[model samples]
Target: MNDGGFSALVVLDDLAAPRFSPGAAELLALMDSVADACPLDSAALHAQASAELGLGDFGPRDYEERLEVLLAAYRDAPRLSRAGRVNLHAQFLQLLKNRLLFTDLLRREPGIAGIELAPPVVIAGLPRTGTTHLLQLLAATGRFRTLPYWEGLEPFPLPGEAGVVPEPRRERTQAAVALMNDAMPHFARMHEMADADHVHEEIALLASDFSTMYFETLTEVPAWQEYYAGHDQAPHYRYLRLHLQALQHLRPGPAGAGRWLLKSPQHLEQLPVLAETFPGATVVITHRDPVHVVTSMATMVAYTDRMFSDPTDPAGTGRRWAARIERMLDALQRDRSALPPDRAVDLPFADLMADQLGAVERILAMAGERFDAAARSGAEAYLAGHAAGHLGRVDYRPELVGLDPDDLRRRFASYERRFLPSEEPLPVDN
Candidate 1:
């Protein structure tokens, strides 16, 4: 893949070709051979979760329908390889255990439901549109309650796991992070990640409800996507609020911890739901040229797809993600008015890249939070430690994904006109 005039730093100069390392290949082979042991059957998964957690109640039976539908889709999915099945089964089981743990916690401590939550500040945008970086900067300010990547993996601590030293949850997450980095070294270059304390999207919480775009990230699942699109996600969004409350109750933060800071691309398509779930939230929408978004997203998808499926279809990934972005943009444009004008902030990619602290200050102002000395110090520290492109840079070419820049520009014309700056020059396709 050729660089599309986006980055100059080349820390990984030897990675001219895109292929999985030998270690990764061997690991995938082992996983494929053991695929039969990790069945994708919903019944088997539910039993395993209950057995593991010693909890039987799954909160509500409504989620069962969604789970069944998802499992069926996975079973019938054409492109899902054996390794994909094993990996997805593990993810599915973890979510099942998460659901069980939450239900058990709520049953024991009914007060968790009564815990009031302050309105959150949410960042809504597509991937590669400065969402992750903005989330990190704001989180660094130490003014808002945010979900860590480790907590997102397992929201509820396992039974008898409270007040323990070193935090078992964090240790497990660190191991997982190391394994992923070893398997896909270039991932951090495209999207930076951390072990315990990195800011993560609430999309992980939404996964317990079995209604999120996260599933589609693994491989092509058109039926699951169609099913997800047909349903109203308001209930699931409310479920996400409940998860947040439980998290707050489990680990009580400072007095102002009620005001959560959240970001997720899923929020782009669920603007109305987000507004309903967390009223008076400061909604920040980040804008970038759809061409750049599609190119970078397709490249990341193909790179990660090696762990599950073989013979990456960059062209198909580009087409699917382009359509997905189009739908999210349409939903955003239509329902943006759902949020009050006073609580809305539109941040262009160029502006954020040009002056990150300025963008953070603007967002904090919109959220009615002061950009005081502490906030400034934290933001500056984060900037110094995690400079952009520090991990390295990947040269993403639209042609590698069979994407035509002109066509993408035409397709996203209305969105660009509405949100992006008119004077922003078109990105060159090398």
Candidate 2:
């Protein structure tokens, strides 16, 4: 996805795979020009990572295991571009730096451990379902402090770094975004981002734990994916809380009191753990027809993977991601009763987009929060000034990704009956 300081991808046409711009192509060729070692040496990489961060106790020993799997992926994956390799390396270094710096902060300032968080406001949904749009609206209210793109990229400051000074990574992030956009112009249509973009994904912070959906977005590594699935993600969520506390301690919230406003598609399946990590969290789950969810998400993944692959599997992407979404739905359904009724709410994408502020008001009301005049006015202004970015009216056929409408409908039948009864029914033939 977005490498270094940014993350994500989409845009489609007549081919099984999208074409790279000439500049992007030339850049990839140059990256391939000077070949180096394959399957980067894990020990050497760790040593380099250690040196990169001024050498600290990188906390738990678990991340190194993930590093091995990732290195194996780079070495084995065929047709990976040189630029793709460079991006992956940059991402790994960032994660290691995050782990070192974050742990160092906690060790030196145990008071950071005491930084209290109100039950956070979490926006959960399938991708492209107005989740990001909602977070932006809420963030504009100036009532919550969100995880900005820069914080997620680095997550913590250096050993003795603090103050309201200019961001240390500001120039580097802008340069990276420029280079990425300059090479692949289509990126803007996929998911727009900048160095200071607010309401960033939680997956970026998960990378510090070396357990994240970020890797899944970048490549097709079944072993790694399987390993991730089998493990207990509660530990990762535990680390997630620590990182959030660290962020709050580093940059005191608005007026010395504001909750964390976090969003991610990955949260759909981890609701239980999320609830455990932050008790009484106000969780908002957004729904869209699974048919749209699968195909669109596949396109997003297609764009990012294409940077690292050629002849990517659109249909396979469809099938795998479709299954994953359905599984998440199933998990949510199973755990629905476990969540506190007053603390949870559901919003349909169509409704949220139609009246974004109203939908948020409904959500806040359910969480026992007030939608004050200031919030209403701020959201109205945000909507008046900004519009959803244009994604041209190009067709995205489900069959192209090997998905059958009826089959997907059956797969998501329970989800529909539970949360989308009044919504548009899936187009399926008996």
Measured by TM-score, the strongest candidate is: 1
- C-alpha TM-score for every candidate: 0.94, 0.89
Candidate 2: pairs in clash: 2-6, 2-7, 2-8
Instruction: Give lDDT tens digits, candidate 2, residues 1-430.
Output: 2232222222255236566668777877776665363226667666777887677688888778877887787667665666567667767777777777877777889897777878888898877676777888887776777887777787776655554367666545666777777765555555556446545877888888878666878867666777777877898988888888888877777762378888988888888888889898888888887777777677667656766666677777787788778777887888776668888888877767767778878877765667888778878898786565432222356776778889988888888888888775342110
- Show model 1 residue runs off by greater than 4 Å: 1-18, 254-257, 425-430
Q: Whole-model lDDT for model 1 versus the true structure?
A: 0.84
Residues 27-97, candidate 1, lDDT per residue (tens digit)? 78888999999988999999999999888999889988888888888888766788888999999999999
- Candidate 1's error at 317, in angstroms? 0.6
Q: Whose lDDT is greatest here?
A: 1
What lDDT does each candidate get?
A: 0.84, 0.72
For candidate 2, what is the TM-score? 0.89
Per candidate, the number of residue pairs that clash is 0, 3
Quote the lDDT for 366 in model 1.
Answer: 90
Off by over 4 Å in 2: 1-11, 14-17, 34-39, 159-165, 389-394, 425-430
